[model samples]
Target: MDCIHLTGIRSYGYTGYLPEEQILGQWFEVDVKLWLDLSSSGETDAIEDTVDYRSIISLVQDSVKTSKFALVERLTASIADSILALSDRVTQVQVILSKPAAPIPDFSGKISIDIIKKR
Candidate 1:
């Protein structure tokens, strides 16, 4: 299978266990790898032949920016499910979500979750 990779999608969202986190939304980064067969799209060179990534971006944006969750695990699952709903051509999906500004004391790097789902 072929894949489409989207990385470094940044959005502001209120999703955390802490009260301050919910009150003051933080920046989140999302990465996705969508697996599908691109042979037809490669041959035809038509938009209709392949997944529309702009639409996928819209879905991710809405999911991240418009919803609140206590865990990025749930958020990641939601993103994978939503992407799967886009087309049957997608056989599998992987989502990586990160909170770079996580409120952990003395943390130097991003805190993140990664999940993979198959249809």
Candidate 2:
């Protein structure tokens, strides 16, 4: 299957376990991989034949911006499901959700969840 990779997507979200995080919100990042047949688009070179990635990016940004979930897993699942619903060409999706400013004391690393879904 042909795939499109969207990387380094960043947005602010209120999804976190801590009470302060839920109130204050924080920044998050996402990387998505979408799989589908691009041969038609490649041949036709028409806008209708290929996925309009702007819509995908908008969907992701809107999702992260308006959600208030407690776990990255839930957010990722929602994103994958929404992407599937948004486009008929998408046969599979992979979502990687990241928390760069986790509230864990004395930690300077990032946390991310990776999941794949197939239609």
Candidate 3:
């Protein structure tokens, strides 16, 4: 299988357990890996034969922005489901969601979740 990776996609959205987080929103980063067959695309050299990444990005952005989730695990699973629904070519996916500025008392960098799904 061929894989397409979209890493470090940044977006601002409301996703957290705190009230302030839901009201003020926060920045989130995501990385996605999509697995599919690329033989037709490689042979024909046509974009139509491959998964359209722009659409995938749009789907991710829309999903994160419009929905609110308290846990990154839920968000990650939602993203994986959305991607899987978008194309049958995507046989499996790996999703990562990161919160760089989480309101943790002792954390300085970020917290994130990594999830894998096979359809």
lDDT of every predicted structure (CA atoms):
0.90, 0.93, 0.91
lDDT of 1 by residue, 27-106 (tens): 99999999999999999999898899888888888898987888878888999999998878889999999999899889
For all predictions, the C-alpha RMSD in Å is 0.8, 0.6, 0.9
- Extract clashing residue pairs from model 3: none
Cα lDDT tens digits, model 2, 1-119, are 99999999999999888888889999999999999999999999997987999999999999999999988889999999999999999999999999998999999999999989999
TM-score of 3: 0.96
Residue 93, model 3: Cα distance from true site in angstroms: 0.6
lDDT of 1: 0.90
Question: Model 3, range 1-119, lDDT digits (tens) per residue?
Answer: 89999998888889889988888999989999999999999999998899999999998888788878877788889999999999988999999999999998987989989999999
> In terms of TM-score, which candidate is strongest?
2
- How many steric overlaps are in each model, in order? 0, 0, 0
RMSD from true fold, candidate 2: 0.6
